[model samples]
Target: MGELDRAIADYDQIIELNPRGPSVYFYRGIVNARKDDHDRAVADYTQAMQLAHQDQRGSGDRKAQLQGQADDPAYASSADGQSIALASGDGIALRARGGAYAAKGDFDRAIADYDEAIRLNPRDKEAISARGNAYKTKGDFDRAIADYDQAAQLDARDARVYFHRARVYWQMASLAKSLTDLDQAIQLNPKNAYPVLWREIVARRSDQLSEAAKQLDATKWPAPIINLFLGTMTPEQVRSAADDADPVKKKGQVCEANFYVAERALQSGAKEEALKLFDLAAADCPKTFIEKQAADVELGLLRASR
Candidate 1:
């Protein structure tokens, strides 16, 4: 077994021995979350939180011991939110449970958890960013932008926050602001394909597509996508390159191809055709991919316009 698996096994044995041990449940939740088992992770965190709450009204030493469980290195899920992310000592379980809820497409509950987390620790920027993402998915762009603004003020180097804000601007049809945020995102994380891809797109809409090729650097997988935007590769070629031996990864790449191409078509004013491709993207994208959320947003926006 991998280290996380062995750790989980140990935690399982511990849980069997001391079923009421909140620390064991919490640590197991962390291991399970690292394994991408978000459901179990959420359950563990909930149980931990319950036990901690119950023990809080006890003797001074016991209360202190329970409070000591909060630590900066604690994490419940990943940034992609097929889980949660790292947190500081305050309200860790709530921050983590919010992530699990987001990963499960339960934005309202996620937002509630994030609200509590932020109330407990106003400087929890990761939870703030994840909350922004949840708001974005829920079609609450204004609130999403507000949260991202807070997160950026808290940590200017967070590339995904800029990316998230860029998408929000794109949604609002503020293409210039979207391009500006995408520029910041690319400047922060040059190798991230999402911002690079969207920068070309937003630039195209701004009639500045020509200089996009200057930003290109060749790489695997998404290199084909970059080439497609540069006019050096066709849609068919990009799709062909997206084909992979790993079925799960292949699904995401193909979803990206459809979404990007559909976006290009939308920019080119091919509304009906873009709708068809977007449908494919929405149906095919992995649940954890930000593009899947974007695809759903696109579909919603287009349908509302119709």
Candidate 2:
């Protein structure tokens, strides 16, 4: 077992021995969260919070020899001596639960948890980012953008925030702004393929085709992205392009050739090949709006034939 797993097991044992031990529950929750068992983590945090609240109602300073009350002034101030404040652990747990719910596609619940987490700790960037992702999943792009903005401001070093904002911009059809954010994302993490692929696609669709093409060529665009474009090219043209000395350059030419092939197929009743290319393009450039549009066209044709 991992250290986190062992820690969680130890917490379980401690909790079993002392049901009202808020610290034990809190630590267990943290361990469970680290293990990605967010539901159980949430439960542990809630239990810790409840127990913590119950310990806070003492009339005057009274000491509890047990539960490690010596370090807590609030516990010492309580008359019954049973009271202790729940640490920031509850907030941490709520944030974790929100992220887990978001990952599971329960955006509404995730947002609710994030709301509570933010209420407890307003400056929690992780919670804010998780909420933003939930908002994006719900198609509330404006709210997502707002949260992502806050997250970026708070954690400027996080490339993911820029990447997410770029996605929102793309959704809103603010292509230039999207491209800008995508460029930042790529700058921060060159190995990330998403921004590079999407950026290239947006560049292709840009009104200033020559400038966009220049930028794309300068970037040394990936072969898969070039292949996706070439899937739309004409078969003969693709064959001729493949004869080029540089395979990388050939890929771009092939992409253009495939585009023509796919386009001509669509025009000449070769629906099958056209659909295949469309599917290929979508797979290679999922973030491209045009691929989705082409997918819609292919789907429409298929539906009509049925």
Candidate 3:
């Protein structure tokens, strides 16, 4: 956190030195977004877009000055390269601001931004994937899948797209399809623990516990929580592993731990206990965590069924 604060301070100095530099504002916006300061991130991204637009217009002497700077060996090798770089920067700014909007739950606005970013750079796999996420959040599953399909075609090796698409499949109750995508994602990026964790849940939900247990044995996941998932660690032990000094961290850990335990309880016919754990997870977990999102979804279905 201190490092991020110092980085922001440095960006401020750079902005002061080059007030018209869009890249500095864009980078600062990224930092602010990471800190969950969405409003500031939006403001900085807006400033970046405006600057990028002004740069694009080839404003009087500004274009000539930029071209001259490009001639410097320290900058770009040629003016054309610099122009391409500047144009790409605008697309990046749009996509980044779209992400901030998505984080704020303004899916409509986020989709609009992602659309424009894609228009500016048709080959932007990240923009396409982001648009899919916004569509998923809006419960437009078909459109989300379409975007994910396009993203996959654009970059077949991107594990994140597969992971996200798997989530949408899970939400759609296409457990078999979700499992396939999750399997592909894990195969592509074995080091990413998130896919492994979700795969275990999905496998169990699909009544493939034997397969899940086999896969779990072959893959080594980190920490007390993985032990909880394997039924080797108690809920109390999982809770103990959470950092007590940090309320937010503790809440996130406890939320995730309770969510997994709730799943186990549900499987064991302890419906009442499962409901209690789900309620605690939904109430205490950070909204940004995937576990909280799943918890909320589960709770909604539970209430609907009742």
Candidate 4:
């Protein structure tokens, strides 16, 4: 957390030096969002958008002036190049702000920003995938799938795109399709922990528990948390492992530990205990963490079913 604070302080000095610089604001927004300071993130993102628009308008004026001097082909070409670069930068700013809005749970605004970002840069796979996430959060699975498909077509080797698509399939209960996408994602990025974790989860959910166990046992994970999924370590041990000297790391680990314990309780038919554990994970975990998102999803599904 202190590292994030120091980074923000550095961005503050940069902003002070060049108040009109949009990129600094955008980066600061990301750092603030990661720190779970949603309001500050929104403020920085808003500033970034404002400055980016100002830059775009200035670039447009310059391009118009150069067009009036079309006799100078070199001037016109230079203006065109500048305009294209400015447009791309603006698209990036919009996408960054959209992510901040999504983190704040303002899906409508987030989608609007993403739409403009795509319009400005049609081949932006990152923006496409992010828009898909916004649609997924809104329960518009069809649109989410379409966006994910587009992103995959744009960048077939992007493991995150496949992972996002697999998540949507999982939500729709298309377990086989989900598994297929997960397999592709893992094949593309074998060392990525997210795909490995989700693959195990999908396998377990599909009643392929033994297969899940075998796969988990065969693979060496980067995080000790994988032991929880493999059933080699008890939930109590998982919680104990979270007892770290660093408060932030300890909080994150505890959140993950609670989530794994909740999954274990749910698998053992202890719904009440699982719900309690999910509550603890949700309450303690930072919103930026995948564990928090998973816990929220589990809690929502549990309540919906009840």
Each prediction's whole-model lDDT (CA): 0.76, 0.58, 0.72, 0.72
Two-way lDDT contest, 2 vs 4, winner: 4
By summed lDDT, the worst window of 10 consecutive residues in model 2 runs over 77-86
State the RMSD for candidate 3: 6.6
Better of 2 and 4 by TM-score: 4
The ten-residue window of minimal lDDT in model 4 covers 76-85
Which parts of model 1 are misplaced by more than 4 Å?
Answer: 1-14, 21-38, 54-90, 205-217, 243-248, 265-273, 286-288, 300-306
Please give the clash total of every predicted structure, in order: 1, 18, 0, 0
Q: Identify the superior model by lDDT, candidate 1 or candidate 2.
A: 1
- The alpha-carbon lDDT assigned to residue 73 of candidate 4 equals 26
TM-scores of all predicted structures:
0.77, 0.52, 0.79, 0.78
Give the lDDT of residue 240 in candidate 2.
Answer: 62
Residue pairs in clash, model 4: none
lDDT of 4 at 102: 75
Q: Which stretches in model 4 have alpha-carbon errors above 4 Å? A: 55-57, 60-87, 205-222, 243-251, 286-290, 300-306
- Which model scores highest in TM-score? 3
Which candidate, 1 or 4, has the higher lDDT?
A: 1
Model 3 ranges with Cα > 4 A deviation: 56-89, 205-222, 244-255, 283-288
- Provide C-alpha RMSD values for all models, in order: 4.4, 13.2, 6.6, 8.2
Residue-wise lDDT of candidate 1 within 138-229, one digit each (tens)? 88999999999999999999898999999889888999899899989988887667787887766764333335435556777677877777
